[model samples]
Target: MSAKITLIAMQVCGVLFISNSAFGQATPQDASVNQGTSASQDAELEVLTVEGRALSLYQGNGAVFATRTNSDIDKIPQTVQIITQELIEDQAAYEISDLFRSMSGVSYLNYGIVKMRGFEQESQVFYDGIKGDPFRTFTIPQLFNIEQVQTLKGPSGAAYGAGEAGGAINYVTKKPTFEQENTAELRLGNKGFFSGSIESSGPVNEDSSQRYRVGVYSSTEDSYRNNVEEDNLILDLGYAWDFSNDSTLTVQYTHFDQLGERLRGVPIDENGNFLTDISWNSNEPDDEQDFQSDIFQVNLEHSFNDWLSSNSTVRYYDTEEVIKFHQARALVDNDDDGVYDEITRRYQDQTRIYQGIDLASYLVADLGEHTVVAGADYHFASEDEVFYYANGVNNGVSNLSLTNPSYDSDISAYNATLNRDRLTELDQIGVYIQDQWQATAKLNVLAGARLDYFSEDYIDNEDNADNTSYNDLGYSVRLGATYDLNAQIKPYTSFSTGLTPQTASDQEDSLDGELFDPEEAQQFEVGVRSYLLDNILNLNAAIYHIDRKNTISADEDGNTSAIGKVRSQGFEVDALMDITPRWVASINYTYTDVEADDISEDNTVYRILANNPYHQVGVWTRYEFPAISSSIAFGAEYVGERTDRTTSYDAPFTIQPYTIYDLSWQTAVQDWKLQLNIKNLFDKEFALAGFNEVSGAIVGERRRIYLQASYDF
Candidate 1:
């Protein structure tokens, strides 16, 4: 069934392209209408006044956000998806993951972890086009101060720094506006959930040359999982000064405090059946994961002339995280019983502190028919970490029973011993340049290249004999072309390469002092984009293949090697339509196939990548009634079956397919707005494939309902 659906989707995509190409010889009136539609869409967000305020440094142009180029998106040959503030508000998204349902080829794992295309991404997230956030790995990303999100699919090493082949996500934060605006909101939900927030932005002086923005948010919730709850607080403050008509300087400070317990998921039997309640938590009652962060940033934008400009940012970050948890190591049967009776659990405690500084600057020049962008960035980061652990077998602790569990045991009884203490420092410098040129009346070409130098100094405080340092230089390149077939259709093709550096820790258990090489990735893509139905419907379709080499793996002796290879290919479609005066709808679908070579067997066999589905679909529709100033919306997501492939498991396990639905309503009266949302409306019971055999399967979210109220002044 999955293969059949994939075949049909390919046919549908081909047909759409063919039909649009055949319409290239349009009539004069049709061409004129299309020209108007294109013009209107191009100027949609160009001008901002009292009613619509600019949020970020690049929001005013609308031409450069994700790619950092002055060229329009239609002319760029990469797949870029943008989630607007209006859509974010309509969905009432609290965190970045909440908006993943509307994006193509994207999936949420846990916390800030995400899977794009077919590869898992943990450290690929960015902010304002810059890489690295101190707390990204420790805490969930809140949306209170974020203006929009841009998903750049495919290898972007040439434009950004080192990254995987899957893609990257950039969060555009809000900036100070010269217009006065203030809002206060409160929300209440089931499961002991509550939240409150306040935001204000306006001018600091009578001349409006100086602007200020401030926001405060707090929330607490007891999640669906047993013994899992979270409390969060966030604060943002920003000030901007227009020192000159063509130059601006902005300063911003942000702080975050988060407290939560880890959700390790429930164990499953060999038959792919849950061994206990889905909500069962393996962590102890006192286990907690806490994160605290502080960030300070400065941005400066200056126009050298009508044809040249520069944008630069310097940021400093400090963060700390502490965690203690119980992890299920493996399933065991005491006395050789046919049925699994005992589970090996490990208790662990860790503390880490990270500090970093990042600097990036870009110069954009418009030279006749070509727009050029050149930039350089520098990053310096240091981390101090300590770890302690105690395993059931190694410590002679009693194993927990699989079918029967007791939570009354004092966690202190399992005394964890010192494991490792480490301190590391990393420095990276990158330089890149790109040019977008109009080769012909209907042909646009883009080419870019980047070079990076990175060095890592690792020190094992516990044993200086284990210390190691490594440094290397790497390069990436990108080339793409787009041809406008007609007013409504454009076809494009691109080839790009990416690289990810290996840390010293990845080779801790290696033999012969053999260090691993950086992973290399390359992708080839072809796609078509169209504006149909007099610009009421927008559609984009693409097919791409990505190959990654030098993936790290371990051998039977626990020796690490970079001999693994993985490949992923997929077809995607995204469409947005205005069905009528009061109706709006959007749909996206993705079909992915991924295979990885078995490293343990010396790459003799290929296995399907676990935790990723072959087919996924998303749909959303909304209707508005002007009479009551209200709107209602419906959303649905479908995930196809997946396989759990791991050497520890005797055989491959299959995870069934599932679908989830959501509904929401919003209304406005005077200056007050009210909203309600029901997620997982049908309360479906489902589970997702986990990282490995030991991690087990994760339980899906249950039904949740919430109400919100906001007042504007």
Candidate 2:
């Protein structure tokens, strides 16, 4: 650890201890005065009430990224889902995948890939409305410092340029608050897992114009599989200043460090069955993976007058990673004994750096019965990447038998043969504009458009030769309308377009040095939002159809072309209700149908898309007992069967469906709280993902338990 980080940790610990001791001895008069003053201040601020917080799990009133303004959810003509801090705490979530239980039509695949609406969302992740590279390190961002997560379905290309057709996910970080709050927590779980964290936030000045917040977290754990372990540390800090002109400036910084051993899946047998009998990891004990990152951002908001306001944001990100592991490459049957004989291993190394900036300004005006909003945005990004690979035989390691494996082989030969090296550089820029109008008392309209330009450069570092350079320009647009039938119900419809630029690697694979055109997609959607029983019950439903063109494919003659097309259609529904004053429940379901046309042969189509489930359902409920200040929650998730096709054998296979259950209990006493969570209640064995060629499969985690205790000052 660095000296600066060590000093900060010591200071935070000392402050937490001193604050707890001082707050424990308050007199009755002081306590009463403090309560009265806090209530008065809360009335002047837009604080979230207990009921409002509870209702956020099912529906949120407003979101900034959904419309680039503080517009009500019912007024937006798209499907959006918000996952709040309360839900994160109740589920004891540590990673992004754990929070997907509250959403429908989304799937978490291997290597942290999230799929939505039958499309992969590998490059469509955002933080505070700014884009971030999700595949940079192959690890999802930790959820310890996040306030909420929002998902906007369908194409948002008109607002954010250069992305996939699967939509986008934005993570909102915790900000400094005027009210004083501090907390300390400790967690213990199975497999020698232990974690601790401290959080503090409050005003730094008497006038409450300046505020500060800080959080520190550290954890260590051993995995269920052999030779796998992990350690991690994270630090976050924030400051906000409210100027005399009624404007605000906020700055934030975060650092993360993680080290662990990579886990490789077991190879499949000849009969296309997962090797469940394997009790040890395939990689050697010396294999390791390390990651480190630093992030900084600044945000400014100013109001020129009552009818016009402007906001801008800037961010910088730096990340470093190192990986060394033995990967399974191929399975061969050397002997005719009906069993796999040899397993080959490969080694790889990669490094990448990413930096980006986004600037946007907005104007709001009112003329007659119409409310008009206009905006313009500009974005720029640069990335550099390098990769190297080595085979097992050249590295001094020998292939092993399937039934009997040995780890005594040396890796010195492998380290000496790492000669291949490649480099790639990418740059992008975009501009956009949007407007929203209230046509009448019960009608609303929205329209937007964007233009983008991007370029890519590639080179072979070892050979000192340039490969290729590619560039392209693209445009997108969106239009929507909504009608309010009553105070509790609204119906809407929209049409949107999306575009994705091809990379240098994609172009290099084409025949005769011909570059492929960018992929394009269009979608049509209809939805309804309703609330009943005095805003205690919330319901939402949506149906959508998408058509994608110019997808790349390979022909039997070994030539690549952009003559592919795909169609996807789906329906989703969600409901959340406060059954009484003490009980809460939420339910979500989705049905998807996806098909692709034949690119290798004429007049042929696939029945299903790989790794995409046709049906999904999730349910969660919580009940509280005020007498004991305790609450218990129950949840269940179901994933339907999916299909995968093998190209070499021209055959199809199926992955069976499965369901998992979870339970949580929480209790509070005085200034302390305790919680217990159990996952995979039935200890069922299942596969999270697999390949149709019978190469390997990823096995889901087994039953585990976690217990945590926290104190508030």
Candidate 3:
């Protein structure tokens, strides 16, 4: 059934493109009507002004401001997806993961940074044009006070350093506008859930020269299935001081603390077949565990002069997790009387810190019509990972030896076991130059490259002799060109490069010389972005061919093995349409063509486990009623089924495409404001996991509702 749907989807998409192409030739006859329809649709956000400025907050509400506008989005050469704040509010999505229901070609690999993508790790994430956090952290975002989110496809390495080809995701935080902003919400639903938040930001002075913003959120809940609950809290504080001059200083800090259940993959039998009614018990009965992850960061940017500028940041992360499952599932009998054996227990804790300085200067040199930039950056990060495992009758694999199925108010009974500590440090220094020059009024040439030197070291506390260090040098390059086929449409092409390390494991004998060469991943991209219907609507489409090789895999002998490579090529189309005074819509689609260059084992390798799907799509739209001062938005997402070619056992695992319908209403009653949001309107059961890996399993969210009211002085 899934296969049938996949084929039909592919055919329809092809037909739509061909049919649209044909319509292109009949433009003269439909030109008048097209202009009218386009205008009517565009009226939705064009006339709308935020306190009287021709700005679009909802159109790209969730996108990075610098890259969300029609002028910039249409001028760029890549595909992008925008999830506006309004849309977020409408969905009442409390976390970034909730967005999977309305996104395409992207899925959480393991509820973390291991998301499936056409790019490698080390990809960058941004919040208001500044780095957010390390990609490996897989930090989930809080939505009580976000403005916009932008997902840019292809390598953004040109603007962001130490990036992977997976493109980038930039989140724009809610800013303290010149005018007052106010909102409040409370959510209560099934599974003993309760959540609440309040936020306000505006001018501290009558002149609107100084502003302040604060947001706080907290949630407590027990989930569907056994031993699952969520306890999370978030805080955001910000201030902006705009001096009389053209200088501004904005200070913001975000802190989040969460204690939630660890993710669990679906269970499989001895034959490698998934269990029929796998325990709805989200709890790992054998593992009776809990997790806590906390993060905090500060950002500062001072525009001293137009010719020179500096940006700096400080960040810290701490995580603690405990696992109590038995490594061996089979039972054993020490005596002749057959008896069962229990699983052991394990726990892990980690702390990481990062401090960095990035300073860039835009040179005012007479180099024709060229925008030249030169800069240097230095950063250092250190991490300590601690692990422990225990064995005792009190800590067995089964419920008998572990906590009972029922809830436990206190968690003081467990004891610590074998303990191990590992420390790792990374230091990097880089310099780069970039130039964006217009060859002609109709064409632009862009070029940029960076040379980065990185050092890494690992130390084991007990075994001093096992400690090791390594270093490597890698260069990232980007080249592209854009042609203006008039101001309404432009076509562009680009090529970018990135580095993937040869190995992720600790180097033993040769940590310095032999294990330090950085492998390369390359990408070729071509796209056309356009502004049609009077520059109010946006249409972007692109095609890309990406390849990765020289990846280090493990051999049967557990030695370094540079085996096969992976490849994916696809075409995509994304659009944002402002059709009416109160209606807007967006869509993203990708059809990837993938193949393996080689594999350790032909049959077992390059299998369905590759997870490079053939097709993916997303669509979201919203409509607001200005008369009633209320608005509504709905979104849809689809992901094709996957096959496990290796086992041929659930060879065809069908994860039916699920749709989540959401609606939000916002209006003002004098000083009072009200909002209502609904998520997973259909209450569908599904998974957003990316592949056949053990981590590719999740119990999707169910129907949820939220409501709130607020008043300001």
Measured against the true structure, the TM-scores of the candidates, in listed sequence, are 0.88, 0.89, 0.77
Q: Model 1 Cα displacement at 221 (Å)?
A: 0.9
Stretches of model 2 off by over 4 angstroms after superposition: 1-16, 21-58, 134-137, 269-272, 333-335, 359-383, 400-405, 415-420, 463-466, 512-514, 533-536, 601-608, 644-652, 691-695
- True-vs-predicted CA distance for residue 701, candidate 2, Å: 1.8
**Candidate 1: misplaced stretches above 4 Å?**
1-63, 136-138, 332-342, 393-404, 507-515, 554-561, 601-608, 645-649
Residue range 1-713, candidate 1, lDDT tens digits: 23333433453344345434322221111111111123233445433221111111111224365558656678889888878776788778888767877888986565677778888776677788876576656467888889888888989899987877899888888998877766677788898777777677878788989999988777787887766888877889999999998999999999988889766666665555777767676676678999999989999999999999999999888999998877888778777867666677888888989999899999999898898999999988899999998888566445666566655546667767899899999998999999988898789999999999999999999999889888889999999999998878999999999999888777675676777888899999999988787656678899999999888877777677887888989999988776775677778999998878745543222133665788999887888897998989999988888755454534556666789999999998976799999988998877655544555666777888889987665
User: Lowest lDDT 10-mer window, candidate 3?
Assistant: 23-32
The candidate scoring highest on TM-score is 2
Write one digit per residue (lDDT tens) for candidate 3, span 507-535. 56332336735656677888887777765
Give the Cα lDDT of each candidate: 0.77, 0.73, 0.55
TM-score of 3: 0.77
168, model 1: CA deviation in Å?
0.7
Candidate 3 local Cα displacement, residue 9, angstroms: 49
Question: Looking at candidate 2, what is the lDDT of residue 231?
Answer: 79
The prediction achieving the highest lDDT against the true structure is 1
Q: Report each candidate's C-alpha RMSD, comma-separated, in the order given.
A: 11.2, 5.3, 11.9
Cα lDDT of candidate 1 equals: 0.77
TM-score ranking, best first: 2, 1, 3
